[model samples]
Each structure stands twice: as structure tokens, then as C-alpha cells.
Target: MNPYLIVPLLALFLNLSLFTYVLALKGKHRVVHLYLLYAGDLSLWIISIVLYWSFLPIHWMPWIFKISSISWLLAGTLFLEFVFAFLSKNPNILLYLLRGLALAIFPITLTTDWIIGGVERKYWGDMLLPGPLYVYGVNVLIVTPAVYAIFLLLYESRKEEIGFRKQCYLLAFGTFLTSILGFLTTILPRILSQGDLHYPPLSGSASVIQSLCVFIAIAKYGFLEIRLEKIALQLYSKLREGVILLSTADELLYWNESAKEILGFSKSSSAPEKLDLGNFLDGFTRKPFTRMDFKKKSESPAKEIRIDDETIYSTGPVYLEVSKSEIPISGRDLGKVYVLRDITEKKEASEKINMLYSRVVRDLDIAREVQNTITTRTFPDSEKFKIFSYFRPYDHVGGDVLNCAESVDGKIEILFADVSGHGISSAMVAAMASISFNVVSRKGSKPKEGLLFTNDLLSSVVTQHFISAMYLRFDPKTLILEYSYAGHHAGLLLRKGETLDLPGKGGVLLAVGTPILEDYQIQLQAGDRILLYSDGLFEVRGSKGIPMGNTTLVEAVKKLSYQDSDGLIRSLVSYSESFGDGIMTDDLTLFCLEISESA
Candidate 1:
């Protein structure tokens, strides 16, 4: 088998595989499917050059060259079509002109030796020269459009996503390299070496290399489908937050329009390799330009520069948050990234985010040992009752709170209060309520009296929010439980294998300063179980986003009342999570108290 014949056969198989593979991997987009047509035609051109130039008889070789060259002509046309569509451009005039020119010269080139002509025999094989119509056929139809496609790749890459633009850059370089190698093999070797080298015969592999580079871009990075909208270029540059990308040596490689505007650069100014950080020091007035100065100012956070003077965007001093991070890892240093955020617009929101960030760090350490935190448990000195409770907020601080007081008299006061909302503000109100309840209890007031005094305290302090509460006083000797609710869910009681709601007279929500209605009473017996919970328990959303109602809560309490208080709370939490598909939408609080006959 001739080595030349084997190379063409391999190229034929590779292009065939590429055509089918590109079509199959269309990813529901038709851009690459059209490019496959080019690959198919190139495949045919490779096979045609072998048969017409080498394998065929001398009599048929000249005419066969003209006909076989049509596939190569179509291959170039299809490649240009692919480029236009890939860039989301309409190819109306130039594309049609190329096609028409190729069709018009096809018959003339086949009969007369005006296009391909008779090839000159070179070192290994025959070399075909561009004949009389080479300018119209090859230059106008093929070479011009191929060069234009490289420029199109570069232009489109600027508006693409960062990672994808990088892929496009590599792909464009491959296209350029393939074109250079093809030129070197065909036109360069022919002009420089004369009839010494058969460069034209070996040029088939360059097309295959081009196709492989294109296929890699398509299959690996999804270059065809994932191009960013071109409008984003203007928007990215026009964003209020300034973005600057610098090299390892603190040279500015790229900066957005906002950065240029903030840095006092005119719109017409071009990028400089080394930006003066000394000039930036005046903008960042608080900290010195040195890293040692930054370390002395703040140890943890990257400092923000406050731009107080009137500028383009704001009339008041704009507080711009400065954030710097290392760019994505590469062998070549892409430098560090610096971002400036306008935190002046919403001072409250910025403060809240900072406060939340601080609380998150503080709570992480506090949560590690929450043994004596907000949800601490205590039992009355009586052996008749055993109580266990659980509380967990969505954040570090919570509105749900519980306080147990063993009164000087033969009374045990248990108060469970839920502020109207979650977070720091609500927690503060809950804390205030807890303190008032303790103060009222110390004065030897009844559960109703303490609740009334607490409501008045809430109305004075809490604004734009309210509290829901249940105050209970239990007499272990008499087995009497008296409770009063202020806009709270009724307590649940499990007695004699049935669940019962301890419906109590309800008053207005506490922070409104309304007087409590008459308290409700329930006589406790042996084997009686009582549950006090925040609405967050039953308000848990399921997979369908529907809240678990009180009916579900009653059933859960009745079924799991046999377990100890800790086990019961844990089991109920587990059950709620099972219904919710493990998504926690709100805080949870559950308190279980069981009466034992043996005790």
C-alpha cells in the first residue's frame, strides 16, 4: 500500500466520522450541523484529489481534477456559511456572490485548462497551479471568506463569556495556524521551492486539522449555544460597580467603564500596561497604599474606600466597598481582580448585611456549645412532671423563647413567647418579654397578672411587630393547670389515647397592649401529656409548599407522646423534615410535658 494512498484513506475515514459525530452532537442547535456539510465536502475533496491526480490514468487526470475540485469549492462555501451563522450574522450578498461565481466557472474549468490546468510533476507527486481563473475561483470565492471568518471569530469572542471567549481565542488561533500551515504547504512551497516539493498534494490534512479544532470548540465548551448576549458588553462596562483586572506586577490589564470613570480616565483613553496605584491612594483615603498599612487597619476584611466627593453617579459621598480576589488559576498570571461596590445607596441594607455576616461568625462559635444558651431546659422541684423542650432559630438569634420559674408559692410558672418575626429585632423583644415576665413573677403575681404586665411592656418597646405568648401556672399537688394565651396557638393535650386541644380564651397579640381575657383551666390526671409549640413547628412547608396544619400536629403528638420529652421532640422534627423533603423554611420550637402516676 502506498503511503500517500493510506493518508488519503485515513483522512476520508476521519472526516466521515467527524460529519456524523458533529451532526449527532448538534445539541438541538443547527449551527454545527451545517458545518458538518463542510466537513463532508472536505472529505470528498480528499478522496477526489487521490483518485484524479494519482490513481487515475493520464488521459482522464486533467478533466477529473476540474470536477473533483467542485467539492473543495463547496467545502469553502459551507465553512463561510458556518462562520456567519455561528456569529449570528446574516450573509446575504458575499455568500451568494461566492456561490454564483463557483457555479458559473464549473463548466468552463472542466472543459478548458483555465482553472486547475495540467499539474507540474514535483518530487513525490503532481502539483496543480492556480490557472487563469484562480483570482475569481480561489481568491474571491474561498481565500477571502476564510480570512473574514478568522476576523469574525475574534470580533465575536470579545462579547462572549470569559471562559468561552478563552475557548474562542484558542479556536481562532488553531484556525489561524491551520491556515498558515495550509498556505505553507500549498502556495508557499510551490513559490519558494518551484517543482522540488509536492506541497499541494499534502494540503488535505490542514482542512482536517481545522475541522478538529472547530469540533473541539463545539463539543467541549458549547461555544455555539453559550455565547453571551452582545448587549452585555455595554451593560458590563456601564455597571455602577467598578471592576479592574490587574497583572501580577500591579499593572492594569483590563478595567470596566465604571473603573475608568471612577479613576478619572476620559472615555477616549486607552488601557495602559502599568496603572499607577499611587494615583489610586487618594481615592482610598482611609488606608495607606502599602499592604502593611492595610494589615494594621483591619485584619480580617478587605477595606472599602469611601468616595465622598460628588462624582458621575451620586450627589452625596458614595461609599464604595472594595473587594479583591485572585483571578482563576492559569499558568500565565492573569493578575488579581478588584471590585468596587456602591454601598451608599442603601445604608440600612448594607449595615444589615454586615451585621448578618458578623452574627453568622459569632453564632457558629456559640452554636458549638449551646448547652446554656437561649433554649436552656429546667424542671420544677416536683417528681410528678417531666418537661423537655427544643428550640432552633433559622439564624443565630431567634424570637422564640422559653423561661421556667419555680415560684415561691406552690406554683410553677412556664412562659413560652414567640415574637411576630425572626432575627435580631424580634429576639430583642423576646428578651424584653422574658425579663418582664421574671419581674412580674417575682412580685408574686398570678400567671394572668404576669402576662398582662408583660403585654404592656411589649407595647411600649416593640414597634411594627407583636408577640404571641402562652403563660401557664401548674400546681403539682392539686394537679391543676391554668393557662392564658395572647394570640397564640392553643396547647395540645394527649389523654386516654386521644388528642385534645386545650382551647383557651385568646386575647390580642402582645405588643398591642390589650388586656388579657379570662384564663382557661384544665385538670391534669395521670398519663396526661401536654405540648406547647411555636407555629413554626406546624407551619413547616411540605414538598408542595403547603403548611402542615394543626390536624397533623395533633396526630403527631398523639402518636409520639409515649417517648421521653427529648425523643418526642426529635421524632416530631424528623417527621416534619420527612414531609418537607429535608428543606427547613422556618424556625422550630417544641415543648413536651408528661405527667407520670408512679412519680
Candidate 2:
């Protein structure tokens, strides 16, 4: 083998390698395909040069020279196509026309002597003799298009982003170098010397420099889809979540800064290149990182682990949410990506919130117990009259209070009050109202007088809330009933299947204003029932979003007039609950008084 033949042979090998590598890439895009076309042409040009120098036979020289001519002629058009594809630009008409010209001139070189002309045996090797149109062909077909492609790349690089622009500049510089070296070593010698060149053409060997430059651009600055991979890696490195990539053999391929920080790896030290998954996770945990059992499972849920190493976490124990997912390619398991999220703050905050919530719940339970003791759970019943009361608070504590007591004169005093709202504050107001009622009831005040006294006390003490109340007094022997209201809903009097509203004379809410109440008297016949209730029952909304107003409640009470006092209150509560889908928007209170038939 001649020493000079080694250069073209090596160049041929490099071109073939570049072509094969690009073709073998998975999911090859348009730019890659165009590059493959360019590379294939370049390889052909080098192959023809190698064959021409081999001196195969006297007759084969013309054919090899013709092949070399065709390849070199098409090189510029193919490279321009690749440039356009790389820049993501649509080719102009000029590109199409130049491609057509190259194709049209290719057959001319192969079938006729217009372009290749003839071959001459030189001291170094066989060289192609230039035809009459060879100069025009070389300039028009090869030099012009290659120069234009490099110019376009340089012009477009300025508008690109910093990273991509670097790639474009590198590519342009490589192509320029290839063009300059190829022209000087091959075309210049051939045209200047005609057919009697003393030295062998080194254009094929010179192409290796361009291929090396392209490879450098691909490896360092990232060209084509490799640039996308570089971008992904940069983003992955910046993630707050720790990410670790492992090969199928459990070798550590990649890990981000966050992964190092999470695993408590020394920040100053570099990662070991040959570390396995087990060694990577060794010092991070004591239990073999959940025994690496998650890798065995096809679908694994995120696992929370507590790191109690005081040396790593100075504040306290660190909580991490670790998850693993298999990275598969083309139905084959490539590796696994382990993600670690620092959930220490979230975990601690959640625990603190739960503690506060538990304390509130316990306090509310105690408040409900105290309110239950203060509010009346049972009402006094007698042969002459039967009393029934029901109360349901919207929350753990209620604003509604119902109480019944016998005065010094033996008159049964009943008071039912609803504060402005439900919950702890309102329940406290209800308790105050209960105490006020008890104090006035012991003094044996009249129905109107009792409300006035209760209002006076509440108005002076409570500022944020008010109370609506009804006070009633009954004489068992006389069968007479006296009632007064303070900004409360009208009580219903059920008599002989007729419902009548027992409206108050001066209805003013307590605690907000002075009470000016008037007591009303009604003669109660045997079996007559009076119903007193808070606004919560009628204020509820049904499924159609319509409120169960006072009119609907009065009609419902009239329908259930035949039932006894307890049964009537129970049925009414059930009706309201059913209408509102068992959702209580406010505190509910019901007090029913019935005169027995025997009375």
C-alpha cells in the first residue's frame, strides 16, 4: 500500500462512520436525514478518490473519475439542503433550481465527456482531465452552493439564541474550512495543471477535518437533537426535586445537585463515576432505602422516609418523598429515574395544623358539654298541659335556648330564645339569656315584663350579637295563655284544624335595642296546641334552592295538628330535615305546648 493512499482511505473511513452514526440514531429528524444525504454524497466522493488512486485498470479509470465528478458536483447541493434543514428554514427557489442543475449535470458527467473528459496516468496516481465546461461546472455546481450555504449559516447565527448560535457558527466554520481545503488541494491543482498533476489529490483526506469539526460541535455545543438533550440536562440540573438516573445494571448514570444535597453527599466532593445504585444510597439511609423493594414492583407508589441524622439536618429530622419510575425505550427497560422531594416543611406544617385542630375540637367538646348543662333538655309536663322541646345546633355548640320553670304563683313560665348566630359565641349568648329568664321567672314577672328585663340585661352585656325570644305564661286551672315576643317569629296556635299566627304587639330584637313588648292573652280550649320556634327551621333551603318560609312552616304545622305535642315537634323536625337534605344551615329550636283533652 502506497503511503499517500492511506490519507484518502482514512477519510473514506471517517465519512462512512459519520454517515453510519447519523443513520443509526433513533428517532432521526429531518435535519438528521438531510445530514445523512450530505454524508452519503461525501462518502461516495471519497470512495471514488480511493478507487481512482488504486489504479484498478486502464479502462476503469474513466468510470471512477466520472463517479468522483458526479459526487463532488452534488456535494454542494446536498450540503445546502442539510443547512436549510438544520436552520429549520424552507428552501428558496434558488436551492431547488441548483439541485435540479446538479441532477441534470450528473448524467452528463457519467455518459459523456463534457464534464470529466478523460483520465491521465500521473506519477502519484490517475487524475481526471478537465473538460471544456469543467471550470464552469466546478464553480457553478460545487463552489457557489457551498459558499452560499456557509453564508446563510453565518447570517442566521446572529438571530439564534446564545447556545444554538454557537452551534451554527461552528458548523459554518467547519463547512468553510472543508470548502477551502478541498478547493486548494483538489480543484485548484486539477484546473491549473489540467490532466498532468504531479501530486495525488488530498481533497478526500481534507474532508476529515470538516467531519471532526461537526463531531466537536455535536459533542460540546450540541448540534441537531443533541442540543435538545443538552437543554433537558440543564433543566434537570436546576430542579428543586432530586433526580437520579440509573442504568439497567444499577450503575449510576446521572444525578443532579439536588440529589446530592438530599442524600447528604459532601457538596465539595465530586460524584464517583463508577458508583452503583446500592453504594449511592448506602450512607443515605439505614434500611437499604426501603430494601430496594420498589425496583421489583412494576408500579410503585411514592414512599415517605424520615432521616434522623442530626449531622446532615441540623434543625431536625428531614422528611423526603421518594419515588421511582422505569425509563423504557422501544419496549426495553433502559433504566430508572429516582426522584426525591424535600417534604420536611410540608410535613411539619401539616403536623402543627393537626395539633391546633385537635385542641380546638377538644375545647368545643367541653363547651358543648357546658352548654348542654345550662340549656333545658327536659320540659315540665302535667295533667293539664304537656310540653315538648327540640334543639339542634348547626355546629358543636348552639345559639338556641329553651327553658321552662314554675313561678312563685304556680304559673308555668316558658322561654325560647335564638341568638344572632350559631357556634361558641352565640352559645354563650344563649346561656346568658337562659340565666336572665331564670332570674325573672323567680320574681314572677308578667310575660311582657320578663322579656323587657331579659332584653335590658342582654343589651348592656352583649354588643356583637342579639337575641330573638318568646316568653309564655300559662294558668292550668283557668285555661288561659299569655305570650310575648321580642323580634321573634310569630308563634302558631293550632285550634280545630285552623292555624293562626300569634303576632306580637312590639317585636324588637334583644341586645341591640330597648325592648317594648306587649303580652297577648288567648283562651285555650282542651286539646289546643301552641308552637314556638326559631327562624332556623324556616330559613333552610330545599333541594330547589327555595327557602322554607314562615308561610310554608305554618301550613306544615296545621297539617300535623292532630298529633300530640311531642309527636308534632318530632314530625316537624323530620319534615324540615327532609326538605333541606338533612343539612342544617342554622341552629333549630322547637317548643310545643298542648292542653290535654281532660283539662
**What tens-digit string does per-residue lDDT give for candidate 1 at 1-599?**
33566667776777787677666544355566666666777888888856744644566766667778788666667878877876678887878887787787787787787777676554344556567665456656666777877888788767443445655676677667766776676655645654245434455666667767766765544444333223443465777777776656665545787887665678777666566544553344423222211111112233342212312121234344566676532322345666665443333223333343344345544322221233456666557888878888866667787888877886878888788787666665565666566566665666677788776545643566787788888888888998888778888887877778888766756544576556778899987888888887778788688988878977888888777667878998888888777776666788877888764
CA lDDT scores, all candidates in order: 0.65, 0.73
* TM-scores of all candidate predictions against the true structure: 0.40, 0.45
Steric clashes per prediction: 0, 0
Q: Considering every candidate listed, which one attains the maximal lDDT? A: 2
Per-residue lDDT of candidate 2, residues 395-492 (tens digit):
88888988888877778988888888889878767766776676678877788888887676566556788877888889888988888888887888
- Per-residue lDDT value at 257 in model 1: 78
Model 1 error, position 356 (Å):
21
